[model samples]
Target chain A: MKKDELKKKRIIWVIWLVILIISAYFVPFVLLRGINQVEASFLYWTVFAVAAILSTIKITTYWSD
Target chain B: MNSFYVYLALSIYVLIGFYIAYKSRQGMKQGVIEYFLDNRSTGGIVSALSYSATTYSAFMMIGLAGFTYSGGVGALGFELIYLAGLSLVAFFGPRFWLVGKKYGYVTPYEMLGDRFQNKWIAIISAGTACVFLIPYLSVQLMGIGYLMNGLSGGEIPYIVGVIIASILAISWAVIAGMRSVTWTDSLQSLIMIVVSVIILFYVIYTQLGGFVSFFGRLETEYSNFLSVPGPGFFNFQTFLGLTLPWFFFSISNPQVSQRLFIPKSLKAMKTMIKGFLIFGLVYTLVSVLWGFSAKLLFPGLQQADLATPTLLGSEHVPLLLGLIAMIGITAAAISTVDSIMLTLSSLIVRDLMQSRDEYSDKKQLRIGKFVIFIIAVIGIIFASQQLDLIATLSVTSSVGLMIVVPTIFGAFFWRGATAAGSLTSIILGAFTALYLQFGNLSPLGLAPGVWTLIITVVSFISVSLFTEAPKKKANEFLGYLDKELEDKNIL
Candidate 1:
């Protein structure tokens, strides 16, 4: 309930979102190109999606009221 | 695929929907709020399913599968980001709920009108939504038309498809308003995911030789599908352009944003968010896999959109499953179109027509019902035009809606946000998108969606600084909200 705590938590989320977007975008483009295996970008994105969902679950646990 | 089966199944589906609608109205309260919003008391499970049905549409199975059939892995990334964007609800949901409860706001635009202290803001936003959404709604009807006609080999006329969709959508929506829509949407959402997933595994196991060979075949045979810019359709810019507008889709699109107001409590909303995320992930994977199967089984088709229809009609899937999947796709389209109509009708009634203290709830609900019917007719006319470019039609619908995002974020986060900023963003942003789209011009080689977001956000901030902020109202509105959220630990 403290002002600083709310501000901190929100800032953490914003930063996480920025990092998530950057990784989801360029990392797959940069890291996974030319890897034709199903384990390439397909697997990368699956892991990426599951990771995003898990992170969201962690954040949502803090929701109350 | 006989026309008789399509006719018979649809008739039975309509009867079941109507029976559910009739039952939903058993002890319904009378008023705009009750009709439009289920008196803000929808339970978590129904809310979750209805929200899923409303947010997703025929696009997932038919359109998204086709996207994967052509574009490949990028489709999954594009859609998963939208799910990740559900994190936005974690921040915005509680805020919207608190304000709606406190102000008795019937629509998101009405809330914005009050927040910005300008009636014109509400009018412009509600109108802009219609400009984009009506065509989008028409696209859903066209999906039905194409599905029914395609499956029946044109024995069923296209007009019949549109009429059937309109009747079901309009009836489910008007029959018991949100309650009927929600109940029916719950059923439709289940059928959509269930039927599609079943068909997915059926194809994988029976035809493609199960998970190991199915995925192994894709790896060896269609390896281009495993990475970015696959097959030259989803280059980086194209991916961002498509996903960016859709990422904001949750709050910018009024139909979904209004769902933020329907859950009876914060706990219910938490459930809604969790349910939608899991449903969305599973459905996205299902559609993508369906597309991959299509690519592997029936390659070299002239059109990517043919992937779904081709698969459904193939000898691989059983006739009964194929028929049920067709009905599931129809259900998906109807659920989406009806939700849009109900929200747009509320917007027209509350924001555009009625003076705040002048109209009674009975009169408003009466006009609301009438507006819904007219909206359905206009939808029929639009669908009759037959705009068939799937990617263009899909992305274009979200472009104008994206114009509202900055104003929304500014309203909630920055107290300096003003009505002038909201108007400038909506008007100029829409103009930019329309010009770029019609002229086939994307300055700097960026997409219209990317440009619209940039212009709208820049304009909103710049315009708000020059205009006067409604200081007292902002304080009273936001001051109360911050404290309430803090007390509740919502952040």
Candidate 2:
């Protein structure tokens, strides 16, 4: 609940998001080449859905400070 | 393919639009701020819906669906990357809202101009927005025209559709400005989601017999439609090229970024962000599904843009549902066009005019309305040109607007960023993007978008490094923001 804590939390989220984005960009290509189309799409969507959910949580919690 | 049905549907939509416009005008005071931004009184739902509606134009159903149909799951990945890019919103939304509220900023460029302490920064940014967004708005109008004409089997002329779209766009914005646009956009967003959901269900259950069967068909019959480089389109580089500009869309696009200032409270803004993300996710899924369904039902369509229309007119889709889908597409295009028109008008009146003393609030509102009319007329003229695919035009506009990204980031985050750097980046970057696009030349096979972004960043940073920084003003602005964010507990 401290300002420093909140800043740290936000920083963590930012780092997570950057990692997620990079993965989202490249994972599909790797998946498509290595796996079946359905598997690749499913993996891609799962990652995207997780990212979307994390974003929603991050926005909703931003005001908690 | 009854022209009468299309006309009836459009008439009903127009009547509803007029009713919404009239209601939006109630209790509305006539002033520049009130007219342009609804006096910053917009609530969360309207903000979210307007943002979603404005962001997802007819491009989603028509262009994106077609992209998926031709380019495969890379379309979904491209759009998801865009959704992922909304992380920038989470970072910048609070900063924008606090600054706008504190400074009473009317347009996004106003914030930039004030932050940089250079009116030319504002003017140039506004000019860049106008140059790119006008063509973008024209594409929205063209989408409606093509949809109506295609649905009617050419019983209605494309020009008629263009005229109708122009009229609707003008009336919606001119009638009540942001209030009317936001209200109608809310309705349109709901219609867009609902209709797409219904159509998705119908396609999956009725036509394809369910999700498993749908996937089975995709795997067994159309496996190429589910991965990158499938059917030789949407290669990794091409997909990156197309999506790179869109990744920064929330900040680069003035219309959507301006909405960051509209929610009446931080809580409301939170609601808006969450709501829009949900809407975007579901709508995106529905659009991609529509594309996959089209691939299964109607294969070998010469034009990728024809995917949506062909699916809607196919034997499986009910005529009534198809008609409703047509309305939904029209709503998407009009909602987006009207928002762009309003934003452009604001940029012209507030940022470019520079002499606010010359015009009263009443006079400013009038000028804004007049600009909207002129923009609509110009958009109609451009739409009549019947440009290339909607997706291409839409991406080109985003790439063109991407030149402003460095300037915006500098305004918000970088103190060392100078006005000289911002201006140089925008001017040179915009020219580079335009030349590459027009000349059909991509350096080293990289997209114009990537090239523009790289050049713009290099110019922005290197110039700022060499130039003097606005230390005092930067401290004042950023200091105030830090204090406000802390005081408001908005971090």
Candidate 3:
């Protein structure tokens, strides 16, 4: 892989992880409060977990070394 | 509800466990590398299963379900946050593997000691790990002890369960070290996961009337449980405090961190990462649902921890399935305890005793084996006391270990991280964790975990800037990683 490519890829993955984690902490408590259904927060977290797992799989899929 | 069934199930499990151990050691060699690391040639699937088994414990069924029972949906988020933290492994896995292979490091502490140009780094890191991890070990034993006693309707003594776990953990580990542990871990991981999945589906479908019905019941009666701060258990600061320490668990916990060095190939490492994530996801959902089922079925329980045992003993979960689940939970605790013993043993030999000029590799292995026995004994004694402090220590262990995160990240990313700074952060961070946790002081409504991270980060950076770093070693270490990050085309 090119040095620039590796650098960019690393930055992208790091940003994705930060955003994902921060959202997991804040979104359910802050944004989902007014949503009356309990499944709203529950479903939101389930979606978040699946997204994180998929993101990780994507990040690692191309790994070679 | 008879203890005889528990003993019968365990007897079969133990026999199968020993057979696997014996087979794993068939051609196993003598010496530290072979014993501690399985010669660093473990495959992807076995690595994934063992990693899963070692990471998720009895806490999943009993404690996590209890958390969900009390705190609601936030419990799922708390664990999912830890699951997401495995991203650290993706970033740092290759670096650890390359460095470990190059330096012939047996423990992550050994890697830390060498990277910082300070042997004391290894000693203190290892010492800190042993201190925090023992409580965690004892808690694992106590889980099995209590589970057996409870499952038998009080036929088995609590101490009997504790001793059984310790004896089995030591026996399997000593049989062939990593080989025995990983192989049996793979088997137990399968039993834990498959049985849990089978029974979870059965309970949810039959008892709770399936997914839609289960969610409908919770949504109608216990709606708050589906969200945060439900019944006021997981407020934002509380969640942050608990999750922060665990988010870095992949690196902070030495037993898990040492796993970065064991894959036979880079590809195998990738497989391990992906495999563990999938397993974690399925297992997390299953455990969370289990908790929710208990919340709906038996909402009048006096204590939240009674969720799992109550569910198991109720008319809901079948007798045979419950017995297997008991063994499954037991397997979960033993697998975790098993890995910790081996990792602590390796750290003791590599970080503490390696400096002795007369200590040969064989002798080092000998002492390492002896240390496992000693650790098991101490664990039994501490857990046998059932002190509030032991449970407290286990829960807050990640907080203390989180102090090592700054050193770990700096060692790889920055060249300015110094031994003095590393030592300062570890020592002070640990003290800060101890004071706040024991005193039950949460300054400004922030958790001890949050404060520990804040202090450790501040100390590590400030101390490094003020002190002299081992610049030469840092450059070589970072430079090598820079040049050799596993080029895909070549591989």
Query: Using lDDT as the measure, which candidate wins?
Result: 3
- Give the DockQ ranking, best first: 1, 3, 2
What are the per-residue Cα lDDT tens digits for candidate 3 across B1-491? 99889999999999999999999998888978889998999999999999999999899999999999988988989999999999888888878998889888888889988899999988998988998999999999999999999989899999999999999999988989998999999999999889989988999888888888888888889887777788788999999999999999989998889888889998888888898999998898889888988989899999999999999988999899999999899999999998999999988888877574488878888898999999999999998999999988888899989988999998998899999999999999999999999999999999999999999999999999999999999999988777787354211
Candidate 3 segments exceeding 4 Å error: A34-38, B354-357, B486-491
**lDDT, candidate 1, B424-468, per-residue tens:** 999999898888876778788898989999999999999999999
Q: Please give the interface root mean square deviation for model 1, in Å.
A: 1.3
Q: List candidate 2 segments past 4 Å from native.
A: A1-3, B387-394
> Considering TM-score, where higher is better, how would the candidates rank from best to worst?
3, 1, 2
Model 2 TM-score, 2 decimals: 0.97
Cα lDDT, model 2, residue B289: 87
* TM-score of each candidate's B chain against the true B chain: 0.98, 0.97, 0.98
Candidate 3: what's its TM-score on chain B?
Answer: 0.98
lDDT of 3 at A57: 75
Answer with 2 or 3, whichever has the higher TM-score: 3
State the lDDT of candidate 2 residue by residue for B1-491, as single tens digits. 89999999889988998999889999998888788888888998899899999999999999889988888888888888898788788878888988898889999899988888889988988988887888888888877878888889999999999999999999999999999999999999999999999999998999898998998998888777676667768787788888889989998899999998888888778778888888998898899989989988888899988999999988889999999999999999999999999999999999999997588998888888899999988888778876664334555788988888998888777889998998899889988887888778888989898899999999999999999878888999889977766666554
Pick by lDDT: 1 or 2, better one:
1
TM-score of 1: 0.98
